[model samples]
Target: MPVSLHGQLVVAISARALFDFEAENQVFEAGDDRAYMALQQQRLDEPAPRGVAFSLVEKLLAFNEGGAPQVEVVVLSRNDPISGMRVFRSARHYGLPIERGVFTRGASPWRYLKPLSAQLFLSTNEADVRQALQAGVAAARVMPQAARASAAHPHELRIAFDGDAVLFSDEAEQVFQRDGLAAFQAHETSRAHQPLPAGPFKPVLEALQRLQHSTGGGMKVRTALVTARSAPAHERAIRTLMDWQIEVDEAMFLGGLPKGEFLREFEPDFFFDDQAGHIASAAAHVPAGHVAMGVAAGQG
Candidate 1:
């Protein structure tokens, strides 16, 4: 029999997304691969600080304990193999039981997602994220400067997502982009009974739903739909989820209001949004990932 990732909730994350490697990244950006590798080599023994997604990873990994392992977090990084030593050491220092990795030097690591059977891919690089999404893997470009998850929930994994271009298609977003808010609301209102199309992160939500159902007695998963649509427009988003048979623990239709304070209250381990402005606002209050999809992502 061969080893398999089948039936396991696999997550692939980059070193930069999982740890605070900004200083090293600055050096790598300023210099060449040689300089970055040398610097990483020099700091091999020093454990890196927790990055924005650290809390999310930590909570997700908790599901593996006290039973059959249901979750696997793999390092899918662009760092050279030499630099990977520090990544492993940092994980160990933080007590994260991550044992697998794919270090591609300066090359893109998205190619390994298929072999790993990864359900989700998180990285600091937008290009890699875009490529992963194209390959049908749920992927997000992590906002490195985003605020870390709060320490309020230890045994629960709380995840949040935006509606359009995230869990739902960018059709409404396209209308909003083409016309104005009035037109967008009217469009959604007309199609309130119809289910909105699944967006890039829909697969991830489905996977999370499975994880939430399968895991027993150790760690629990809670999901939320936090969007900027309110009232009549909100009905369509709710109906879409209902049609998909996906149930989120909470839903917020903030309309045009700023999402930061509401997210701070939610204290999600991580949040994903397609729009950069929403991501920027949410990042100030919660760990956020940008799904670079649809018209908003195509914009500057």
Candidate 2:
């Protein structure tokens, strides 16, 4: 029988998103693949340091430790096969049970998400992330320089997401952006009973919810919907989740407050948002990734 990843919460990540390849990425950015490959080959014996998404991947893999696999982490990278050697070695060093990967040399690797059945895709390359989003996969562009995840939640996998363009569709958000705050509020208040359309990351949130229930390991999944909407507008967002029958551990209606301090308290393994400003703020307190789609990406 052919191997399959069906029914698993598969996450596709890039070599740089999995490990600190920023320095070597600089070499690649200088437009020399051979030199970059050589540098990675030279460091094959030395394990690369953990990147921003490392903690999240580690905790998710923990779910598969004691029983049937409930989660899978696949390396979908743009690095060449030679550099992929270092990636696997680093995973082995960290004891991360990541066993599969795709090294495309310099080619775009996001196209493979379909076959992998990945619910999430993380990469340092914004173009790759955007492409994955266009393909309808829950994707994020990891900020390499973001603060590392906190050790506070070793037994728990905490993830945070934005509302508009993330967990729910950007329909209402487009109103807010085009008109003003008042119009957005009125629009949402009028349609408070109608559930908003599904967003790109909704499937990811649903998968996490399922994983939380079926995971055989001791690790737990905690999720939060931290959004800029408040009061009247907030009602619709909450109602939308209710319509979908998904539950979140926490929900923050900050009314456009700076998300850094609030995220500091949350201490998520990772945070996903569509807006660049919110990502920049949260990156200071915790690991954050940009969901480059919807109204926030100006693509909705």
Candidate 3:
């Protein structure tokens, strides 16, 4: 029987997260036997099994085992085409239901995927995903760990994101990245009362907000923001969220502390950040994603 997805959560991940996409590409492009041999050795030596992020794949299997509202995962990729094969092999080995696909030559894959319930699509190809989400597809451009974590926790999807790039505009991130923290803080403080621009995640947040409002009894889905900025800069983050009228169950301004400890305590199903270091650390405690906020390779 076809499983009914009403209120079910679906997540889509990228092949890069599954295997070493870049390494594979280098080998294929160079066609070097030594490189291929080295790649094979590296793959063999890795602690986690090959194909798809093992951490994520394992979580999906566990979710299925728990068995409540059905949770499904779709692995999406274009480069390293054979990556999907490895993902399938791993899922079968570990016992998880994960589908795989490559993007259409020109069309958006998300358009055809709307039938999946409560979708959470993750991709390094943020622009296309953002375009699809803006067109009203239930897609959220996230990293692999976040995608898996979101699927694992079906009852209450706890998602944590960094304020600047993950939720708000990259303009702030640009300022922070190009200039120094003081300059970025000055800019944010100037716009403290003013509304910050909505980001790629905004539409997804709005959709979740609508879902929260329509559903009975408070919010079944929860959100939180753990930001580096504190005090005055914190007010801007609060004001921006308030202006949007979105409900975030928790908000922590870590000042300069690394977010790993706080995120662990929060126990969010998934967390998102642009920095790999943060995602790498958080992925240990929770499913974490690295937001690729632009056009991805092999994307049309």
User: What are the RMSD figures for all models against the true structure?
Assistant: 1.4, 1.5, 7.7
lDDT per residue, candidate 3, 142-210, as tens digits? 443332333444455566777765677667767766787898889889988997887656755665565
lDDT of each: 0.91, 0.92, 0.59
Per-residue error for 42 in candidate 3, Å, reads 24
Model 1 stretches with alpha carbons more than 4 Å out: 215-217, 298-300
Ranking by lDDT: 2, 1, 3
lDDT of 2 by residue, 71-121 (tens): 999999999999999999999999999999999998999889998999899
Show model 3 residue runs off by greater than 4 Å: 1-120, 124-154, 216-219, 294-300
- Alpha-carbon shift of residue 250 in model 2 (angstroms): 0.8
Model 3 residue 137 CA deviation in Å: 9.3
By TM-score, the candidates rank as: 2, 1, 3
Q: Encode model 1's per-residue lDDT on 1-300: one tens digit a residue.
A: 998878778999999999999999998899687998998999989999999999988988888777787788999999999999999999999999999999998898899999999989999999999999889888899999999999998888999999998898899999999998999999999999999988878878887887788664367889999998998899999999999999999999988788889999999999998888888889999999999888887542
Poorest 10 consecutive residues of model 3 by lDDT?
291-300
Candidate 1 vs candidate 2: the TM-score winner is 2
Residue pairs clashing, model 2: none
Candidate 1 clashing pairs? none
The regions of model 2 sitting more than 4 angstroms off are: 298-300
| Model 2 lDDT, full chain set | 0.92
TM-score of each: 0.96, 0.98, 0.58
